[model samples]
Target: MTRTAQVVVIGGGQAGLAAGYHLRRQGVDFVILDAQTTPGGAWQHTWDSLRLFSPAAYSSLPGRLMPPQTGETYPDAQHVVEYLADYEKRYELPLQRGIRVEAIHRDGPLLRVQTDSGAWHARAVISATGNWSRPFLPAVPGRSVFTGRQLHTVDYRCPADFAGQHVIVVGGGNSAAQIATDLTLDDHVNVTWVTQRPPHFLPDDIDGRALFDVATARRRALDAGRDDTGGVASLGDIVALPPVRKARDAGLLQASPMFDRMDRDGVVWADGTRAEADAVIWCTGFRPALSHLAPLQLRGTRGHIATEGTRAIGEPRLHLLGYGDWTGPASATLIGVGRPARDAARQITALFADN
Candidate 1:
């Protein structure tokens, strides 16, 4: 017999935890099915040195306060995992670990999600599996001929692994910057950064105000549709305190121009300049791995689901959290999942009433 849940959440990270929390609060029967062996989705795979850019105060789950931090820069990956574990315990969330969901399609009136373990039937399903599942890497002309080790930033574990090697870190996001900095400080590896957009680096704190205030402004710009054209980078225009400004000006670290082409020996820049590297780390980010949920009529470009605010296009019952640009504040971070979860709870309550 196929077991059924009132609601089924597809991923068990902070987003899934948030959904589970609200479902429990609303007295709804739901189950969270995660592919991994435990909670804290991508955090489990993060390098040991990784730390949340957002402070502990901003990184707490809904209804549960994170343990106080000693300093300011935020806790490491392990801390995040511990906090998530604590949240699940508090809410008594129905989480089934190591249950990899393969496909989800609509069945008559309910959505059916099939997994390696079993099948789950639900009126609605929320995909909290973040964008990190599919790492984006561009085909740099002649990649096959590159006579060097090439790996995405997601595959990287520690700086000690690349010790004494000439490395090229691609992309300009915080991940790339942090990895490059780590390698520079620890491994003494030669590093060259390649990026399409220059990142707007900010201090963890500014005049005692949280860094999220600046992040909120950027989110507003994105929500307003001013960022539609892929125009000039807005990150540079945002004002920051002296430390961040000094870092950018000093070129201690900054973004490089976009990539152009590549050959077996080295990578070529957009300006026709070539740089040699023994290894290349592409920090190009990721995409939604929704191959598992092919049956839902998802409105999206490429493989990503398109959502209007907290609503998942026509699938109102299916809310997406930890997805960039879906909701207010910082929807992509663990701290941002709560607001969407609350909205989802309201939507689910309305759905139950309609049924």
Candidate 2:
């Protein structure tokens, strides 16, 4: 069966929810399709110790502010899940959960979203599928032959699972740092953290709110053709989360240079030393989850679709929201996505007017 609307949104996560709120306000007929069976999207899969980089109020969707969590400077994953569920209910966004979008194809004057259940055609499509589904691990030598257990960010759950094991965490980003901190509490666990370079910890006072402001400033600078200032690239690699602070103060959070290669049961450094590890966790990051859009043949270098604002450069009717800075400054964050989402919805409305 083929259903139709003015817009079809892919990936009903934070990005999709933000766009849905704006599209509703714009009075456009739209539906958001989510692959997950429940609310919270990727938040549902994060490690048990995961916490927001920002305060609840600073991390919110467009239409609603996140309620403050009791005694929490950074809300936990479940709290975020509850907030997203409530946000969905409050807005009454036309979201269809448990529906996986297979591909999006051109259908005459419209675009067709082929899903496992059925098909939906729309005048425009918003691809908000964030990259959690596509975790990335760099090709370290002997990775395939490494005898130790290997896990990526997608497969990691809790540090308790690694208790008493020599765990090697690879990456300098927030996940590697936080997970390392969490692992420090596990009895008899030895964590060997390796990063390409020393981790850059943000100022103790600079939180997610500060970063969002920086992103806003950078966006405005780009708009004026001025030198870009204070984008995420200019900031530290890790936020000073409470656990991270405790671990760092205790001297448990320092990192060594990345290993040159992985051998059976461990990693080897360029200095001809080796550390035996029972497990290796790759907090290496992710690529955009855009396999469904492959049918469009629109991605260029960097495996991302080029964009003018939120609209795809090659397909005006498609808006690729919340991928990263290229789509919009900090659009990947809950707070930063609002401005770009508003722009995308407004552009979609204008496209209809032009038609």
Candidate 3:
């Protein structure tokens, strides 16, 4: 027999938890299906040294503030994982672990969510599976020929393994910068930062809080039907973490333009300059993990399902949460995700109310 729920939330990450929180508040009958065996979602997969740009208080989900970091100003990846686990336990949210959702499709008026464990017939489905699983590496010419070690940021752990090697870190984002800086800490490791364009860095004092404020403003402007060019910091702009700041002070944050292609041992620049390297760390970011929704034929260009708020366009029973700004402004972030999740919960509640 197929199990049933009023709602099924895919992914038990920050977004999924937030959505679950709101759903619980509204007395909605929902179950969050998480792929991972443990809690903390993608936070469990990030590198050990990775720290949030915001303090613990600022980087929290709905109904619960992340417990303050004792000695650390910013919470590390492990801390986040613990916090998420505690939040799950504290709220007693109904989350099923190790249930990887394979596909989602419409079953008459309800949605059918198929997982490795079983199927869930849900009145509404929230796809909160954030972008962690979909690391994107650009199609560079001769990438297939490179014999040296190559991995995306998702696979990166620490710079210790890369010690005494020439490493090329790709992309201009914070992840790229941070990884490059981390690699530079070991004198034996030669690091090169590559980007399509010069990276933009926010002011030293500006952290995740400021970025969240800017995002909130942009969201408000867009909601008011106005242009959202508020001249504030962008999510792509690098925040000046202590280590990043130290790296900049020591003249280590310099970035080079993207290389032309890859050779067997290294990368080749457009100017025909060749840099021999042992590894290429692609921090080119991630694409939305919405493949399960493919059966619905809801994906538009670039694998994105067009969304008004959290609800998928042309498919009212489906909602895409915590993917990115396209779903809702800064919906990918911890704090920003709450807005769309709450809105989705409200809408879903109203739909049930109508019946």
Candidate 4:
């Protein structure tokens, strides 16, 4: 027998939990399908030194605030994981852990969410699957033939393993800056930063909270049908955190333009100069995790489904959350996800209420 629900949330991360909070308030019968065995989602696997760009007060979900870290202004990965576990217990949300969803198919007017353990028939489906699982690496020539170690940000753990080795870090985002800075702390490790373009850094005073406010303003302007090109900064740009600033002061933030191709043991620059490196770390970011929705054929060329707010334009029964700004402004962040998730829940409730 197939278990059914009024809604099925296909993730248990911040976005999923935010949706659950609003869904519970609406009294919707929903079940959150989490791929992991534990409460924390991707936070459980982040690098040890990773820290949130915002303080605990600014980084939080819908219902509860994240507890302030002792002696640390920004919460680290472990703290986030513990908070998520606590949040799950406090709310008593219906979350089915370890159920990796394999596929989602339309069954009549409902969605058949197939998981490894079982299937759920849902009147509406909310996909909050963020991008941590799908890391993207640029296809450099001779990359396959390079015999050195190559890893994406998702696979990176600590810089201890890279001691006494020459490492090349790629990308121009927050992860690239943080990882590159972390690797520089060990004087034995020689680090080189590469980017497609000059990296943009937000001023030291601008933190995640400021970025979120800018995004909110832009979203409000757009909603009011006004032009919003106010020269505000984007969250994707690097933030001048204390460690990153220290690395810059130490001259470790020097970035080289992306090399032309990879050689046998290293990368070759456009000027025919080759830098011998032992490892290449790609912090090139990620794409949305929507493989389970392949059967729906709703994706565009950019691997994203067209959406009006959180609701899928072509498939009304489906809603997407926390993918990126395309779904909602700053939807990928802890504080920014709640607004979109709440809107999605309201829409879903209204959709079923009319029936």
* TM-scores for candidates 1 onward, in order: 0.87, 0.98, 0.97, 0.97
Q: What is the lDDT of residue 6 in candidate 1?
A: 88
lDDT of 4 by residue, 265-343 (tens): 9999989998999999999999999999999999899776999999999899999999988789889999999999999
lDDT on C-alpha atoms for all candidate structures: 0.74, 0.91, 0.89, 0.92
RMSDs, each prediction? 3.7, 1.1, 1.3, 1.3
Evaluate residue 108 in candidate 2 and report its C-alpha lDDT on the 0 to 100 scale.
Answer: 92
How many residue pairs clash in all the candidates, one count each?
0, 0, 0, 0
Clashing pairs in 4: none
Per-residue C-alpha lDDT of model 1 across residues 206-240, encoded as one tens digit per residue: 42124345455666677777654332233332233
- Residue 163's C-alpha lDDT in candidate 1? 76
Candidate 2 per-residue C-alpha lDDT over 280-327 given as tens digits, one digit per residue, 9 for 90 to 100: 999999999999999999989867688898999999999999988888
For candidate 1, give the lDDT of residue 192: 76
Local lDDT at 353 for model 4: 88
lDDT of 2: 0.91
Off by over 4 Å in 4: 230-236
Better of 1 and 2 by TM-score: 2
Model 2 C-alpha RMSD to native: 1.1
Pairs with steric clashes in candidate 1: none
